[model samples]
Target: MSAARDSKSLSGIAINNSPHVQQLQKTAPPHLGLVCITFSKEVRFRTITRTRYLQLPEEQRETALKVLYRENLQRLDLALTFCVRNSIRLYRMPSGLFPMSDLEDEIGATVLEKMSADLAKIGQRAERLGIRMVLHPDQYVVLSSDSPHVVTTSLKILDRHARTLDLLGLPRSSWSLMNIHGGKSQRADQLVGVISELPENIKSRLTLENDEHAYSASEILQVCQRAEIPLVFDAHHHICHENLDSYDHPSVAEMLYAARETWANPDWQLVHISNGEEAFGDRKHSDLITAMPNVYREVPWIEVEAKHKEEAIARIASAGFF
Candidate 1:
């Protein structure tokens, strides 16, 4: 089947109404905010340093958790807190190992429960600072798969996290925004239905993102319209996948405008910006920042995915994003 046909099938299965469209109709387009993942360097280093979990000793495990909590959880709290104090209203947290397939062993229910408690505490802190937290998903959990096991496992992970959130008495919207990649063409229909199956409260928080290989902004918007989810754009993904001709000096302004037109939304649209470099014949994260001039006109929650977090922040500051 064609990508469009696959998207249609997914939409048919996932969306019964158009909440995002209706929302746009009711509210003026809100300025998109700038969001970042804190302590990205430490997290990436640890993950790649050791491939096998069992290779780590007890002390290493403790160290790993400390780093995970510090980077994935604590530092996020600190960054969001800073943003809030500085009048920045939006941010996204890294998905990390939180909702992975091996959560039961890598980070058990008890760990999740503790994380929830910590998040609740962070939420209270955020309320004081005026920052909104959105939890992004890891890239591996694709909903559109022929294997029922993949879909079932993904739902199970979502349920576990949802339950953990519930335990903290946080509203679904509190950490509602989740980022998901558009699935392969063959499984788009099933993916859409899976999205539709999400509870209304969760549905309100879900947003689909366009990836380098799977879909484009226009394609994702159509699926979002049908799935009742909002659409998010990743600038790097677009350039890496669609605008390779201009990769070295990408037209950030034109791309953002095109994405906005595709989604036709003015209400606090979410976007991601990253630096990409060729490594082993594949695009990998690099230390590049979005050109502020191109995106200043639109209020977007920008996350700098670079080789180094401090460098990314420096670039953003130099560009006057702060």
Candidate 2:
């Protein structure tokens, strides 16, 4: 069978045939949010450029990046506008770029300043529409790496980004949600200290997520308690990490429970949902909104990370997330 078909078949077996799936599906949570990333077919820069410099002319790359950035902001504005028109309450801002290292050489103090100013313009639009913009940190920043320098450099970069946020004069709440992947084992302790040492304002906005391997929701909660940062949970990551034996389908209830127990309150909790087959991992454009009860009922934001934004939003809207 083709990969897509194989994946779907696996998901069907994991969910449709499982008794646990039926029960969890029936017992939908009361308060949930839908937070989706601002992504579109025409707007993603990640696949467009292999190397930062090659993406555009050296002299014009900055301008090009800014233009691309604005296009994404506009796309986000349109998405939020749609969500508002439909009465959807929550949405996450495009992290704009991923893996801070990708932009480290490309983005300097001047470029960062410009990006921050531009973000302010985007934030204004979102604020006017009553939308929230959560800035996600790069995914590859492994806090638990044996390489101490990597953690330090990542923190420094994050600090620079925080300063840019301050420079933009964006309200703390709007740009406050900075998501990071808490690294594994001993690395977590060191990263926690670095996170704790951050300036009070920046630290207040930091949130750590549970990844597929490095940490569990419960483990991250412990780290958050030490660092005093908030916790964000990716439901899929928990299931994949825990390898829970009780259910064949992803357990929305268990995921929610993990977040609540670890994070203390739902207000500080954020959830990420995406569609994927167990065999293929997370499919680029698959839709799993229907599989998630909290997404349809309680969560404030559901950021759809799909192959394309149009497909992602259309699928979520069809699932009644909006």
Instruction: Tell me, by lDDT, which candidate is best.
Output: 2
Per-prediction TM-score to the true structure, in the order listed:
0.66, 0.68
214: Cα error in model 1, Å: 1.6
After superposition, the stretches of candidate 1 with alpha carbons farther than 4 Å from their true spots are 1-89, 97-107, 110-118, 164-171, 244-265, 278-282, 290-296, 320-322
Model 2: residues with Cα > 4 Å off, grouped in runs: 1-88, 96-108, 112-118, 167-169, 173-175, 245-255, 261-265, 278-285, 293-298, 306-322
Candidate lDDT scores, in order, read: 0.54, 0.55
Error of 1 at 91 (Å): 3.5
**Model 1, span 1-322: residue lDDT tens:** 3211121221111221433322123222223344444444432312323345456774566556555554555665566655654445765554553423235465545555656667677667766665656766665567887778877776666665555445434566523466678777645677778888887655656678877777865666667767766667776676556654332223434444444543434445667756545431135765554432234234445555565555555555554443
Q: What's the distance in Å from true for residue 59, model 2?
A: 6.0
How many clashing pairs in candidate 2? 19
TM-score of 1: 0.66
